[model samples]
Target chain A: MTTPPLAETILSFLKKINPHQPLPTAEQNLFELALLSSSDFITLIQLLEEESGILLDFTQIDPAALASMQGLLAAFSAAETGSKL
Target chain B: MDHYPWLSPPDHTAQALRMDHHLWHYGQLMTHAELLSRAIDWSIAGPLRLLAILGNQDPWVYPAMLAAHRLGGGFLPLHPAFPSERLQHMLHQCQTRLLLVTSDGLATLDQLLPNLSDSMLCIITEDTKGNRPLLFPQHRFLDSTDLQQLPARPAHPAPNTQAAYVMFTSGSTGRAKGVAVSFANLHAYVRYWQTHHPIGPGDRVAQPADITFDLSIHPIFVSWASGALLCPIPPATRFAPARFILEQQLTVWVSVPSVAMMMERLNILRPALFPTIRLSLFCGEPLPTRTAEAWRQSTPQGRLLNLYGPTEATVAISAFEWQAESAQQEPPGNVPIGWTFPEQQAALLQEDGSLLLSAGTGDLCLAGSQVTGGYLADPDKSAAHYFYHPDSGATLWYRTGDWVQRREDGCLLFLNRVDQQIKRHGYRIELHEIEHVLRARVGHDWVAVIPWPGGTQPVRALVACVAAEENSPTADWLQHCRQHLPSYMVPSRIMVVPQLPLNHNGKINRAALQQLVQATLFPTEAT
Candidate 1:
């Protein structure tokens, strides 16, 4: 699947926080992101929630989006489009 | 009738007491209590106004316990081996009018007497006929002859919130914090434990922890509250754990991981030795997976429970039941402290002042009735850690410096301390994640990931390991890690150390390890 525009923005924000991780693929899940202990996840979530005005619940959000770099970007795109899916 | 009602109440007679032998027998205990009641009455009325219980070895402390309870005087329990200063501080703090000691502890107490106030009385447990300045009357274990002469006193209710005992806690701050646990809290704890772990009349609880440590309160008071047998082990014999448990037929083990590890290392527990143990309780420090695995292999009949709490919160605030099947699969990185007991709540909060409720990870905080009011003397430090939740109203939550994540499954997994979070260059780092990842790869099951101060560069990861040289290849370990972790997360240098310095409780002494690293970096030059 093509990287979603929302995913691109989220990935950019995450990369800004963690220079070591330059690019993120949508397949990366919550466990992987947590393993990296990246600074961007929380900051990006807040930024997206503020921009979209839809207060995202990171705690209950789909584990797949936070699973890998690819998955996180995809989730960000979905959030931007106003669908939790 | 005994003169002191609260001190020597008739209701505290042999009928109310319960003692059990491991072989499911009970005659000797009843007979002994009857005899000891009289002996304590006689001794107290006669020359022996004071008594000292060595506490560690004397299997039957019931009579001594009753004797102190009946006499309307306080029972001052001390670790027979405590350094003079610590012991003196405790004795002074407790305002102990009299001190009871066994023959063995006499020498230690005697050496400390000059430093002690002259008003104190010293009573020995074993018979020593002497008119020496420090010498006093000795009392024997309960025998049939003693019970006959004891006068029965009227019963009165025990004050629930009165100071039952003062136990010293080692605080991160320099001064030791004395947790003055109330009788009400003790009673509540005992009632709570008794309800959970049903103890009938004949059950034997192995009291292994030193009296100085609060965990020992479980075996001491729980036995009394539930009418179970309290079996004390010799302090020295604690080193030889296997023999002690086997001979004592210890039904419950209440101790820290350090003592438990000693038993595991010494091969003290075999399949045959522990059929009676219903519960093996571990607390005070973290239990390494290796030690937990060893215990599981030895005891299949009993349940192993890990209890976690600061002394500030009475003995244990949270507990996790260790299952052999589940543990073998995940093999705990840092065992989650489970959840708060009955009425307690555990929460996490983010740096932005938002509460990270429901599976969110941040600074782990505890709120409940079990949370103590504050530190004994220091209000500034106390105010910093304890805060009231205006949203919750009236109730306060203690800001435990521990950082943790509430897992999706609702288990609270402990991360490192909040202070452990350090920024290397612009990157925030948690050293524990690196340590956990390193152990997952290497043959060295033991590893500590520490950041070395690097001038004008990102802090260097100084990895210390105890990997075996014969079979495990270092390249394979690095390659295995490369597949899972990013290059930045990996340690800059992985060095093999002969042994890691461990604290008294067997945890890798992080402060000492950092000091060792600093020493290596700046070695002393000989003149």
Candidate 2:
């Protein structure tokens, strides 16, 4: 089985959480738009972990890295790569 | 009345509070309070009027509160995270001309200066460094360093009848209502706590709620009056409250039940995590039985109490002690809101102006020292909720608007709010205000905002059902709501329906709307 792209998975999750709002692009800042709060960010991490089977080190992850779609993709990709090793 | 009861003797050496790396002794806290009081007296003229304190939890909050009382003024604490518009509304509502803020709060005020009235003056506690020029040119800013340099003067005695603090809660009409509590009310609360759950000098009380919240008043005043050390939990530690309790070695823990729910969600609520906690009090929102059980398991040695009261009734007016033997007897997943304090009286009244004596449910009416006279500068709104007791001639009772059932044991079980208000994440929100904003945005009066898991289930999210014109876009309506309301007030989901279902009474049937929302969200369950 092939893994889906990190951005695709995240966008799918975002769409699931907010079905009414317009789909956010990868470059859009999720935090500034009030689409996600700190607790929501924590939920996002949990969802990502469940989907990818990669346990994230919550203490090591910077909250700023999850503020934007592009940032979240990068953080997830890095975590997935670290888990594979 | 020469000095407050919290102040230690001049020669005594004991820690009064611990924040981060800072530890303030009781003697030192008194001297600092005196210094701040003298500075305020010299800088401001006449009676202190309304003083606003805006910042995060810090040792300065105690001194600022003490100084405001000493100057015969009411202190209003503003949440630094609140939008500038909400802050401005509160500042104007209470007519706060004097502000005591930290450096961060100064930055927030700087952004809101244009919206603020010109009569406001700010006395900041931290040095601005080179950020002095960032402040509004018309307003004066003084630092704590300057306050320390000023000559000390004798503190003035504040009358017990004077207002102590003003806290703003969400109003159903889309405006924040300021509830001004007097010093006498606070004294009554303090006396009640002293008689029931007394805290001594050795107790280390945990401050979990933000300063802007009424729940925070419990730890602040209770600790001060008892000379107990106050341990403020940082924002990060709140996510893992049980761990924070263990690390801080807190003896008395007071917080909203939502914190316990969060602990349960994180799976961190294990038995014996809080062996040192002697008292665990939960209030603000209804305490779920599961959350209470988890908390009790963690702090088996501590006495668990579920307190219930609105902001209008001071911090809390009634308390129900949770016990393991009576756990099965409580409502499925809720703790009972027990007897009222000695200084307060509670009565349940039905819709037809009849009292619910024994084993009947009705709207809860509270009258006592804790209940506020009314909202500040809003006599109409105050009169709407407050009325003369039918039997007790001339006694004013504030209708809680909360439906509660009186059990055979005399304990009250919270049914639900009589109005459209709901508690989500421990913050009180008015469903009508959301519907009102949506109706205005959608250009239609037929809109119903319902909380999913509707009746009795803790509200997780708001779902707005609107009857819009054919092909009317919901995204635009959501954008408009986002612009006007706070993030918490915004509906999580928007369902555009052709028409809202109404019951035989010609009212928007909330039960139908709630079912529609649930069915739409979970199509599988509906079938």
Candidate 3:
């Protein structure tokens, strides 16, 4: 199962939040970031990817993306523009 | 000389460990270890230095461990994924004398270095054998480079009494406790392979468990001794292992049941799809019969066993062989932990705390050569869990805190835990560990964490219930969890209830809370 990079990152993020239910399309962000710590929410995901065994492709996840749908879409848009998710 | 098969691979030229989509022979494996041991010798002075290997599933991690033992001291394999603070606590608790870090792991170690006052030697290594370049450049650390010569001699194995490896597990007091396994305990576990399971050369055993997890030890020792290949499935790819399995033609499979369940969710565990799998072993959590059935169906020719043990008891002590014909006969709920290994002794602890030799349901306690010595630097904690029972003869018994029932057939059925420790995703978590971090915020102690959709289903995430008043902002409580706990320990969802329901005993009733969380989040789950 080769998931597109964006979908894989989104899937991992979704797993952390709603692990049981598969929800929210890529464009649709039912995000709840009230709990994201400053350390985890970074602009670039290089540091997280470096840590081995992590499932999420940090590039697909914008540290600020989960704050709201706009942030999520903007992050995806940035990723589409070739920014690391 | 004790013939510890694991310490010496039979064929130096045989394919040894496979990782990062590359095959590394035993020659390269031993050379890497020799280079690491030589590096340790140059940096550290003592013979009994405790070496903490800090890295992910990077190629050099295992060699680092071998290097630690080569120096005549013990090794503590740490997961770089853990928060730096937790790593620092472990390093400090051991008063570590030697540390080995893969170049990629240096970033996390960098955060911990300043706080550690103990002047120790740090060796920076890469998958030099795998030809991966150093992720970072520096003169401050020693790197594993071109490695050629074989170890001088498999010098008689280290004294059985000396520490072999120390595994730090989740703690309720907000600090992880290190369970130190002696050379004797590890050897006993490896010896289990000789009489039972009888695996040897040509077996391509799967390596999914992190080095931090004791489950990983089975492949490391068993494969090395038998000249079987230790095929490592990298972390990011572990979730989607079907491709890797078929590609590697992995003959032996091992993992926590959670990983199999995830594979089932992905819909790839089809019938007779993996004929190459000759053996499958699942541990670290309850193995649902449905999951086992699907797994067995996927590998029709493979034999499956559910093994059970605590970290205090090295790796696994008991195993239950699963058969397709006996599906109807298998005990309800999870597969029974079955009988203890031949060399091991198992006794049940009644509610009165008295030990029972047989035929009763209570706490599971193990006593044998496989039981580990007490935790490092924590005598009080050790005393509380490990004890010499009047009936245990000479072996010290370690209380597993697992509630188990001895069936009429003498096989043991795992029911649940006696305490707050719950195994989720093959990772042991102390519920109190999460509660400990949230206690300061909710002074009235109106906080409780319950597994979601709390029924027969495997726990997906933790749902924490907090008093509405204390958790007004909501994000603060979650952010607090995110800041303090590891990602696994953090509660995925926060429920701001007006007040928590209480039991007749007046203590916060976790049982009722579990039901409440189930009812609230999953109303249709059939409470």
Pick by lDDT: which candidate is best? 2
lDDT of 2 by residue, B1-527 (tens): 34653353323477787887889887777777777665563334323266788887567877778777766666889877677878888887776567788755766777777777655667778854246446466677677777877887666666877788888888878787888888888888888998899888888998886788788888888887887888887754554455456667899998878777755654567788778998999987888888888888888888999998898888999999987765676656788889889979888888789766678899999999888888888999999888886678877799998999888888888988888889876677888778777888777788888886776766666888888666678778878887667676788778878889999999998888888888887454321
Local distance difference test, per candidate?
Answer: 0.54, 0.75, 0.71
Query: Compared with the real two-chain complex, what DockQ does model 2 have?
Result: 0.20
- Candidate 2 local lDDT, residue B363: 93
**lDDT tens digits, residue span B1-527, model 1:** 33321221113432232223322123333333333434333233222222334444443444454455443332446666555655666555455545555555666766676676535544444544254442422322322232354564432233544444556544433234455555555555666676787664556677764555667767766765665666765443343355456555667777666555544433444453566677888776566666666675666777888777765566777887777775766554545567667777887877886666689888877776556666545578678877886566787777877777787877776655666443332123456655655676664557776665422122434444443554345445554455434344445444456677889999887777766666664244110
Model 3 share of native interface contacts: 0.03
TM-score of chain A of 2: 0.72
Per-model TM-score, in order, reads 0.57, 0.86, 0.82
Off by over 4 Å in 2: A1-11, A19-33, A37-85, B5-12, B39-48, B57-59, B129-135, B438-443, B468-483, B522-527
Judge candidate 2 at residue B321 and give its lDDT. 92
Q: Model 3: residues >4 Å from true position, as ranges?
A: A1-85, B1-10, B41-48, B126-140, B144-156, B441-444, B455-457, B524-527
TM-score of 1: 0.57
Task: Name the regions of candidate 1 deviating beyond 4 angstroms.
Answer: A1-85, B1-56, B59-76, B96-98, B123-129, B132-155, B172-174, B266-273, B328-331, B349-357, B377-387, B418-527
User: On residues A1-85, what C-alpha lDDT tens digit does candidate 3 reach at each position?
Assistant: 1225545564565555443444555444342333332212331132223332233423134233444434544544554455554
